[model samples]
Target: MASIELKNVIKRYGKGKTANQVIHGVNAHIADGEFIVIVGPSGCGKSTLLRMVAGLEEITEGDICIGGRVVNQLEPAERDIAMVFQNYALYPHMSVFDNMAYGLKIAKVPVDDIKSRVDKAAKILELGPYLQRKPRELSGGQRQRVAMGRAIVRQPQVFLFDEPLSNLDAKLRAQTRLEIQKLHRELGITSLFVTHDQVEAMTLAQRMIVMNGGVMEQFGTPEEVYTRPATTFVASFIGSPPMNLLKDAPDAKPGVITGIRPEHLDITPSGWALQVEAVEMLGAERLVYGRWAHSATDQLVIIRTEEAHAVPVLGTTIHVTPRADRLHAFDAATGKRMMTA
Candidate 1:
């Protein structure tokens, strides 16, 4: 295992006046054996940053250090990192054992060592019984495990995963996520995973880097990012229904935006009047969509309630109150959270 650091990293295309910068000055220190997820929407440069660390992309500025050694000029193979791609790039003709052992074989490792490593990895991944099975015969989750098994056999200092679970179905993705957490606990390998899914980031990451439009929005634990977002972007992007940013909220300062989550708003007998527009039943909870009563604008508000909670009829006026401590305040102009004195 190794620690990774990126100091003032930047990436750009072209040069001089025409240069288009993709990644801004991104700085992060990943501890040894830490599982970090680089999460953001598409085109946010999460993958680009991951590739830069993996040596697949060049850093325009700053230094990248792995295990305390600067590796800006080293090739990907020389970085002692293993990458598991989204496609689960396995050889269809090769058996699971052969696919897992191919890298060792190419590196001229002894046959006995290769066998031992492959066996251990297979046992760890529960692929021992399927060692002789071809890629085509395996299920999607099995194939993904094989991809992971291949990486485990290398015993690299760092593991890079580029949306490895995107191809799996919802159930398989959830199962694989648990499997990955178990694997990390057992091996304690330093891993960096990239994904656009916030749920995956929240579930799998010990610490996550939230990016937006090539900028590092926030880098913190999931709970910190969720509970005390640094900016309006982080506040809105990290939640399920997303935090609601109410412009020109009553009793607020002129330049402040009041933010509240759906679950933080409770239906009350007297508060801000809301007219229910729609309701969605989601198993154990209900989502009530509405707009503020007597307001000229049509900005929508959402409230979450338990399934047994009574809901007003559509078009009926109801009052909702935001939990005071749960409220977030952001500067309307800058979209950054405002500190309370």
Candidate 2:
């Protein structure tokens, strides 16, 4: 395991007046053996950042260090980091054992050592029974496992995952997430995972970095990012149904935009009055869609409640309010959080 650090990293394409900057001096520290997830919407530079760390992309300026050594000039193979891609880049004709052993063999590792390493990784990944099976014979999840096992067998200083579960179905994604968590626990390698899915980032990361338009918006534990979002962008991006951010009354000066998560808003008899527009039953939870009666715009709010059986009927006079300390306020123009305002 090794600590990875990015010091004022910047990336740009082309030059002069036409130069397009994709990363704007990003700085982050990934501690030894820690799992860090980089999350954001598409085109936010999360994947670009990860690619830079893996030496697939060149850094325009600043340093990338792994195990306290600057690796700005090192080739990817020399960087000693193993990466698992989103598409599970496995060899179709190679058996699972060969796929896992390929890297070691390429490095001229002894045949006996390659066998030992492959066997160990297969056992850890529960792929022992599929050693002789080719990639075409394996299921999607199994192919993913083989990809991870290939990375594991290398024993690299860092493990980098680039949306490795994006190709899986919802059920398989959940199951594979557990497997990944277990694999991380057992291997204890410093890992950096990049994904656009907020749920995946929240569930898999020890700490997460939220990026927007090539800048770091927030970096914190999942709870911190979810509960006390540093910016309105994060507030609206990190949740399932997402947090409702409504513009405050225009007459109120320095009036902040108020945010409330779906789960935080509850139905009350005597609360902020709203007109229930629709109700969606999601088996375990009900999504109450409505608009404040006083609002002039058509901004809708979503309320997720566990009481599906007792959900308010549509077209009824409904009252909804947030739990104490659940309200989030943001600057109307800047989109920055106004927690103290």
| lDDT of the structure predicted as candidate 2 | 0.90
**Tens digits of per-residue lDDT for model 1 on 210-318?**
9999999899999999998988999988999998888866788888888999999999989988889999999999999989756545578989999888867999998
* C-alpha lDDT score of every prediction, in listed order: 0.93, 0.90
The TM-scores of all predictions, comma-separated, are: 0.98, 0.96
Candidate 2 C-alpha lDDT tens digits along 28-96:
988999999999999999999999999999999999999999999999999999999998889888999
Candidate 2 Cα deviation (angstroms), residue 247? 0.8
Worst 10 residues of 1 by lDDT: 290-299
Global local distance difference test of model 1: 0.93
Best by TM-score, which number? Answer: 1
